[model samples]
Target: MRISLDGQVALVTGAGRGLGRAIALALAGAGAEVVSVARTPADLNSLREEGGALIRPMVADVLDASFYAQVEALERLDILVNNAGGNKPMPMVDVDDETLDRLLALNIRSVYKTAQAAARRMVAQGSGVIVNMSSQMGRVGSPRRTVYCLSKHAVEGLTKAMAVELAPNGVRVVSVAPTFVLTPMTEPMFANPDFSAFVMDRIPMKKLASVEDVANAVVFLASPAAGLITGESLAIDGGWTAQ
Candidate 1:
C-alpha cells in the first residue's frame, strides 16, 4: 500500500543534496508540500526544478538562531526532518576543541533548537511527526568517529526525551540511523578501496545504503502509517549493528 501525505506540510533541513535532497523529493512525491531548506540556493534551485510546485526552496543555515524563527513561522508544519549535520573523522586524541565545538553546534544544538520550535507548533495543533537524521554510527562505535558518534548518541537521547514528553501532546519524535549511505559527502571515503572494503566487511549485507533507502525510511516515519512508532531510532543499517 502507498503512504499518502496529501495536504501536509514538511520542512526538511539540508535539502540541497544527498540524503536530505532525497527526503525532500520523497515527501513531495508523497503529496506533501515540502519546504526544502539549505544554505546553497543552487541546490534548492535544482530541487525546485525537479520537484516543481510541490517543493518550496528556502535558503538558510540551520545553525543560525534566527532559523528557528523561520521554522516557527510556518503556519502549518505537519512534519519536521532535521537532516542537517556534518562530520569529520579523527582519532580521539587528535580531536581538537574546534572540531568538538563545531560538531556539537551543528548536530546537537541545531537539532534541539529546531525540534523545540517545531514541537511547539505541533503541540499547539495537537499532532505532528519529527524524523531526525542520525547515523548507524549512532548505534554502534568505530575508530576515528568518536565525535560523530557522540553527537548522534545525544540525538538519540534527545529523541527519547522529547518523545516521552510530547506523546501526550500528539507529537512523535523519532530518528533514522542509516549506515554509510552513498552520497556526495561519502563518495571520497568509498573511493579508497581499502576503506570501502572495510565498510563492506562490517555490514552483513556487504553493501552500503542508498539515498533512497534512507529516504524511504524517513517518509515512513513522517507518515501516518507509523503513528505508533516513537521514542526510537529506526536503524536502516543493513545488519551492521546486529553483529
Candidate 2:
C-alpha cells in the first residue's frame, strides 16, 4: 500500500542534514509541505536547493525561544519531527557539567518545548502526529554515552506521557529510535576502528541503519498507516538493542 501525506504540513528540526534532511525530503516526496529547521543558513539553503519548492528552509536553533514562537505562528502543523539533538561521547567520569547541560538542553528540553508548541496547535485542530528522534542508546546503556542515553531515555518517557495526555485531543506522540546511522555527524566517530568495531559487533545485522531507514519509519509513523500506533518507539536499530 502507498502512504501519502498530501495536504499535510510537516515541521522537521535539524533538517539541514543527515536523517532530518532525509525525512524532510521524504515527507515532501509523499506530498507534504515541509518546513525544515536548522541553525545553519548555509545548510538550510543547500537543503532547500536539493528538496525544491516543497521544502521551506527555516534558519533557527531549536533551543531558542524564537523557535517556539515561530512554531506557534505556523498556519497549521500536522506533523512534527523533533530531530535536533547532539551527543558528546565521554566516559562517565569525564562527563562534565557543561556537557551534561548542553545535551539536556538540546536533547530533552528543546524536544519537550517544540512538541508542546506543536501539540497546542494540533489539539486545537484535533489532529496531529509527533515523531521524536531517539536512539538505540535510549533503549539500552552504553559505556561512554551516559548523558546522551539519559536524555534519550527521558524522551522515551516523554513520548509515552504525551501520547496518553494528547490521545483524547486526537494528537499522537511517538518516537523513532535508530541505531548508529552513518552521517556527516557520525562518520568521524565510526572512523575510529575501535568504535566501529564496538558498534558493528553489537548489531546483530552487523551493519548500521541508513538515513532512509530512519526517515521511512518517521514518515510511516506520521502517516495514517500508523493510525493505531502511539506512545511507542519504532526501532530501526538493525537489532542492536535486542542484545
All candidates' TM-scores? 0.98, 0.98
Candidate 2: worst 10 consecutive residues by lDDT? 234-243
Model 2 residue 217 lDDT score: 91
Give the Cα error of residue 36 in candidate 2, in Å. Answer: 0.4
What tens-digit string does per-residue lDDT give for candidate 1 at 36-105? Answer: 9999998899899999899999999988889999898889999999999999998999999999999999
Against the true structure, candidate 1 reaches a TM-score of 0.98
> Cα lDDT of all candidates, in order?
0.94, 0.93
Output the lDDT of residue 225, model 1.
93
Native-to-model Cα distance after best TM-score fit, residue 191 in candidate 2, in Å = 2.0
Which residue pairs clash within candidate 1?
none
lDDT string for model 2 (46-154, tens) is: 8888888999988999999999989988989999999999988899999888988999999999999999999989998999999999998889999989999999999
